[model samples]
Target: MTRSTVDKALQDDPFGNQAEVKYKKLGCGFAGLQGIYYNGTICFHRRKVIYGMPPNCTTLVKPRRTKGSRSPSWEELQVKLGNLKELVESARSIISGDMLAVPIVDLSSRIEVAKEVSACSYEARTSWGREIGWVYGSMSEDILTGQRIHAAGWKSAALNTNPPAFLGSAPTGGPTSLTQYKRWATGLFEILMSRNNPILLSICKRLQFRQCLAYLVLDVWPLRAPFELCYSLLGPYRLLANHSFLPKLAPGGTTKGCSGSSHPPPGSSHSSPCYLKTVGLSETVFEVTRKDKSSCDGNGSTDEADKGRFTFDSSPVFIPPAALAILKIVAIAVGAWRVVAGAVEDKRGGPGVGEFVCCSWLVLCFWPFVTGLVGRGSYGIPWSVKLKAGLLVAAFVNFCR
Candidate 1:
């Protein structure tokens, strides 16, 4: 479809704020389905599939049928199966090729939802003061009940509550005060964060890393409190904004509570900031700078040299204690596995067999190299080195023979 058509379709959908759509013609004649998330919204869309039947002139039966024919011909069944297979293949292609788009509107919706929830909670706290404790206590019960009903597809249950407060607190033996209500809210946040694993996994399955990363960077991280807690958990690379995180921020300035040094200082006249700092999984703080703009000399005067400077600092970004622990365990396990594998290979024979095994291993181990060379330009390695290694191995094997 043309871009205009796709854009129109997205605009019509409630969730299509920042949607991206991709089109592909399936090699097999199957109908297709595309899953899309518009504008950072939680709602998902599956595109409808359309299929064409064989021409009407095609005959289903032979001209001369036996008087007592008990069974249908296998050819008809085969044709039906073929059509079904084609549809399945089309769906698979659309999903596997990552052809779905996320519209901007949906993202805006999610932001609105989060903000509304925060606003509601703030207003409740401000008005009732100590009575907010009981309010939350009652709301928690209603929320849990609503969740149960919602899970069962009773849509009305979701609307039963005036403001739709979830089960978040319980009445205390003594009079519940604002302090107690705040504590309950804090506890509820923790529960949500802990339960967010399933949501994260769903995002990973959909390969929506950008959205998943954004949700974690914003909703998940901010709940930890003390503002610094979020950065400390993210580690050094925290300066570099995540793929998902950047889109959620207000267009120009640095994101609130984010650790990175803002590029071009806050009030510069340039259109956008040059860089953002973020911590990586490695705890290293890296400055992610935008590519320099190309300079053009209109009147043949020499263009000024681009002098943007970037520095990669050695300070470790903050990481959540849990994430750090997991990384350490994974690193230790991988190291141990490599040591064991190497020892086993060494004991099996000498370096000669090992070398041959390694060559075969390379083919399987680095399939990306072959695929990259085929799909892209080159593997980014010297051909001479590869050739020399091959020849050296061939010569050694010949000597052994």
Candidate 2:
């Protein structure tokens, strides 16, 4: 591993005081661990770069044929490997990134900090917690350190350079990739949901506002699927129903009572009921077919479309776009009435450019939903269940709010 340039921020060069120190090495395979000392003082040295991570970091011993012991299974070893990559990258970041006071892992990036950055490190706990809580997740402890370090006036730096200071592999293939994503989303969400989340942490520990916002963005990931899927389902429903939930104009392309007819029929023997139609509309649509021509106007039956809706074996994601399209069609249907009104009289504010723009955004948000409709294996993932739960929770939260 290449030695990184040390930062000049450190005041103590105890290691540099060589005349007062001596070096000793126990017969061990771990490199750069040779014990160091001042005038026969006891202790050691270390490296600044990461080449790779050991598979079983929980134990320093490499998987070997040990007496009276069987080795880990293939699956167990894979899990270890998965964990190793995370550790390797995180260590690399600590060695490279500005977060020395508040290091973050992941994003496949590298950073650097001056070793002497400790000059501003007022907290005495930074050097004390090597193995105190290795098993339990006291990660908030680290977060707290970052908070104090920054609050105390220390600075950190990020470095982007070639020949990365450390190297690691992420999981590949659909199953692993998705599993990893879920794991990350879950962790962030859980943190956000807890008092340990950046918001509360910031309050308790003087965390910077900017850092808190960044933390919120990251921690909010797992909550997205449900809302997105809800929008996705709207598409097909709208297409099938031939209706839209959007608020309608009063009539004749107007918000007020600019009417022509009330929703009613002609005179009967007993009495006459009547209604008005204010908006006039007409539209043309083009659809593609594979072999033959579709010789019918949309005014007829929608048996084929209905059949596709009921029988299509697609993920739920496709629902939103279909719904959005249905909404647009309904809006156009109502607005088109203005054309009829225009023929007889002049109208102005009825479903103007604003309506089109609004509909356009609905269309835009619908695209991802359309893609989700056919999403492969999406139904089988646990994320689906979690998504539904998130939606319910959101609804309840909104109701309470």
Candidate 3:
């Protein structure tokens, strides 16, 4: 049967219903063959599909015939495995986008493919494992297990929440130290760095560094307050692409400063003294010109028509120090809110919210304390210190009110 016919047949059949369908390998040696199978069957003609292998191949063994050249060295295999791991990660990234709204089937498929590729690399390392005992052996397990666990947890949480509403709600711009983003990005960076994959490393860096910074200024700042201030500061300028202000950055518009400009104008006055000075001068001149032009036209400069073209390059549009202070206050409020939410939810006796948010707050609050204790303990400083600090903060807050 033609492709269209087969697709129609599959679509018409109820899931799990049996259908007598003909199968073909198209270009490969296998040709048209008739078969009756369940519609939802993963197996074809009573055999599981093997990826990247020809159909009806009986032997599960890899080709043993060695070419004139010797097999790759242990180091070479390790390098190859590392590259494969990076490729799998990149593929996963492409499939998941931001990991916030990925479909279950897509995520599962990508994870399965990643696991398969990872397994192949591990199998290839068996020979090398004999020479170098357990060095590269644990690498595959660490990657596969850690990634799968994280992805599963993330997916489950996302499913429980309403995505559109969650995303649409105004961000409570609160103070975040950029530490969590840095940590996650650093982990990915280390993996890619170890693999010596420059391309993946570059992508990771952009997402971690630039995107993280953007998220901090946008989502992290507005946690306790309505996003009006944050929106006023960033919405007019496309400082964050993922924000609602994206559509406003049309050609010839003033808001084009964010998306249209190659680099976002720095949010620090100290970084551009000349630009700030120029802005002062330009504002003065524009005001004078408007007054003169209004007199000449005998019609007051229309507010709508007189929307000035503020040159981003010559403007020192820093995040106000007040905004920063507001963010810190908001962060504290967010911590308090979390404590209250946790209590309320606990009282309700629903599924317990994990300590991730509380732990993150603790890290933000007592970063200095945790940093100082990093090298003093038998259990290793970072983990033990952070845990202790988190519990202490949570308890102290819980007792205060």
- Number of the top-ranking candidate, with TM-score as the measure: 2
Note each model's CA RMSD in angstroms: 27.6, 24.9, 27.7
Q: Give candidate 2 misplaced runs (Cα > 4 Å).
A: 1-155, 244-401
List runs of model 3 lying over 4 Å from the truth: 1-180, 196-401
On the 0 to 100 scale, the lDDT of residue 109 in model 3 is 55
How does candidate 1 fare on TM-score? 0.17
Give TM-scores for every candidate, taking all chains together and pairing residue i with residue i: 0.17, 0.31, 0.18
Q: Residue 115 in candidate 2 has what lDDT?
A: 28
Best by lDDT: 2
Clashes of each: 45, 49, 8
**Residue runs of model 1 more than 4 Å from their true location after superposition:** 1-34, 37-292, 296-401
**lDDT per model vs. reference:** 0.26, 0.32, 0.27
Q: What TM-score does structure 3 among the candidates reach?
A: 0.18
Q: What would the per-residue lDDT of candidate 1 be over residues 230-267, giving only the tens digit for each residue?
A: 33223211111111222223447443332311111111
Residue 184 accuracy (lDDT) in model 2: 39
